[model samples]
Target: MTTYPKQALLLALAAATVAAGLTATAAPAVARPAATAVPRLDWKPCATPGGPAAQECAVLPVPLDYDDPDGRQIHVAVSRVLSDRPAARRGTLAVIPGGPGGSGVQRLAQKGAALQRELAGAYDLVAFDPRGVGASTTARCGLAPEDRYLTSLRSWPGPDGEITDNTARSRRTAEACARNGGPELRSFTTANQVRDLDRLREALGERRLSAWGTSYGAYVAAQYAQKFPRRTDRWVLDSTGDPDPQRVARGWLANMSRGADERFPDFAAWAAHPDRDRDGLRLAARPEEVEPLVVALAARLDREPRPSTTPGVPLTGNGLRQAVQNALYGDTAFPGLARLVTTAQDPAGTPALPPELAQPLRDEDAAVMIGVICNDAAWPHASADAYRSAVRKDRARYPLTAGMPVNVLPCSFWKTAPEDAPTRITDRGPSNILMVQSRRDPATPLFGALEMREALGGRARMVTVEQGGHGLYLGNGNACGDRAVTDFLTTGRRPTEDTHCAN
Candidate 1:
């Protein structure tokens, strides 16, 4: 379910640097060593067209591989909007974006105005695109268009729960990445991103910084807090996943089955509501009937695929299933899913494919996503027999997901193994982190957020909002939930105990 922006501005660097044939300076093994001397950034007007007029952009040169610090170099694109009132400014608040491939600069443009209004001039808003993202240095896997489709990349099992096609696709994808993705792709790890952020801290010339990290970014922020305990202030982890180093992304993908099942009820209730009748979006007479109707519709589509608005691309059962998973993320998406469902069930209706499914993803976006997970941790290269058995069980247990969450991925055939282990999130950091997670998030559910909470222990206080969505603050229209996080950020006040915003 992790997707990247398709049309982000790809600003051109004056020159993408390449350091040739020199042995990198190795750091001391006693403590975390500096990757390389932080490069001084020359800030200028950002090239991203839609960003705030006040925002400034910069390029940061980081080692292609930290262990080979002086070797090849790549640029990380960063942006910042200074405090409107310098006299009232407290410090810098870094905005960490989600998706191993999410763009921080773009997010700043989208949220910068609200963030400025929310905090007044308390702090400067700063963000950056991690390696292999946005205007930063990028790599491509040279994957064929078919392999880049959203459905192909998501590892959805074939018809009748068969995974032969998925298995072949996985191998093909990994092979493509290995053949075309060089050291640039291999360096896209969560650990490296943490390192890059620290280097950014040095460039900003700050001893400490506050942060608001969402989704996968939360993991990076947490890791930063763990690695440089004294450097972080007032950290916010919104909609984070489990930090179990052993499972990592694999555990995250596997858990989505349960998450989807939990959040589907919200969609069902919405779809069955009388309010939807006016819009011709109501799917069933009762919430209980919605699930069966969706399930049956998907099964029927498996037998006779429906033509979509996208030429040559038909809506299959898995397409319906993916739509269900995507819709559960937020209420804003419910109408689309309802409409798509109605369209599929209608004899003369033609379905419109979601933008994500309309075409292939950019190679760099796919590279970063696949690289981070594959290079961060190892995946099981289980036999086809083993996979078939597991997929059968997961499908039976969580039919809405249709075993896609637990199916094979390119990680199973990734070229490079992780040089270091995944960072195990622990409670050994300053007690300034506040976590806000929805009670039922399809992407990062309550069960997983609890795992992050437990891992952080005394260092964090969690606010569970009684809402349904992927993000908590600024996501669901839950004022109480938003206020809780805002109060903590603006005034350093918390509920004193892990509490729930039942309203």
Candidate 2:
């Protein structure tokens, strides 16, 4: 799950999704990584153009395969910014990015200054690019350009819930990965990511690390805490997913429909507001009319796709649905999504496709994204008729998603089973985990977050924000929610009980 300041290609929830999800129950016993020497980090000044001015970068060597500790090593790019007040500094805080594709170094650059300001001198901020991400060891499947497009990555079904095309594409994509990805690609699982995190901790010489993991990163952090309970301090899981081992990412995807339904009211209210009339962004005169209006417009688009700014790519019903799904991640996205609908609604007007839809993703970017989720858990190999029936039922039940959530994905035909079984997130860890979630998250819905909370038991205390969005802390949450996270990170004071923060 990816949501942020709405940058191009930062559309993991839409353009590209991730490899795994957290589950509430147990899976087969996990094969822990054998003890290995922590590689040294030779830090040097490496700041991006618009990124943190004082950020330093380093490369950490982690085993390509966790089972063979002395085997091949993959480089994980790491970045760090020391706490300004060394005297008051407590320890290190890792800023874990959301997607299996999200770069932690980039996330640190995006929020480091703000985080540093909020954190004061509590800890040194650190982040990293997991294996196969930016500035790290990478792999690819040499997928066709068409397969890398946001529309294709999401595997959105036909307007009428048809999956024949989706099934064929998913099968072909899986075959390409198996044929070209080689063994290295298969190693890109959530389990390895968690192991890589512990190795990062060892390189830092930190006995216990604090972390703020958002969206998919939250799941990574949770797994880390699960595997190495004694190694975490004041952990915060932001916008977490359900930890059901059987479903994992599939469960996370399926839950998005509920998330969309829960969150759409906020959008409807905004789009129906009288103020929006001034900008010609109003969709309907009333909140109730907004949903129906969107549904009807989508149905109309299904009959005839409209030309878009991008040559050769028309704005279809699924494209509109994707845009809507993406816009739900943040309120700032509302205007653009509204304008898209407005332009498409005009018979003579041409709409502009979002970045993911406008162009195809890079081969490596697409490979890792498809690799992680598909490698995390086993998907149903049920007959095609069964999948079709499920999609039809889903489309009817959750019109906003049009069955995309439950629809087929590249994982449905994936060649590899999870190398390591999924981890069951239990309450066995320290009670330092603080989960802050949106009441209406479009990606990780509140219901899923509740399951995560239940899985963590007393180990986690959640702060539910009275808002609608994917990310919570520092991005979409209100002051109350932000303060909760900041306070937990700095002073280690968690709420006595689960509490709600008013928007």
By TM-score, the best candidate is: 2
Question: What does candidate 2's lDDT look like per residue over 1-503, in tens digits?
Answer: 33532322222362432211110011112232334765777888877666668899887877888778888766778889999888889999998887767777777877888887899978999988776676677779889988877778887788688899989999999999999998878988889998888998999999999999888888999999999999999899999889899998888888888889999999999999999989999988999998888888888888999989999999988889888988998988899889998898888899998876677767777887888888989988878788888889988988998888888888889988788889999999788999999988888889999999999999989999998898888888899999999999989999999999998
Which stretches in model 1 have alpha-carbon errors above 4 Å? Answer: 1-36, 47-51
lDDT string, candidate 1, 114-194, tens digits = 788788789999988888777777789998888866677778888779999999989988999999998888888889999
Best by lDDT: 2
TM-score for candidate 1, residues paired by index = 0.92
Candidate 1, number of clashes: 0
Q: Which pairs clash in the backbone of model 2?
A: 19-372, 19-373, 22-242, 22-243, 22-244, 23-243, 23-244, 24-243, 24-244
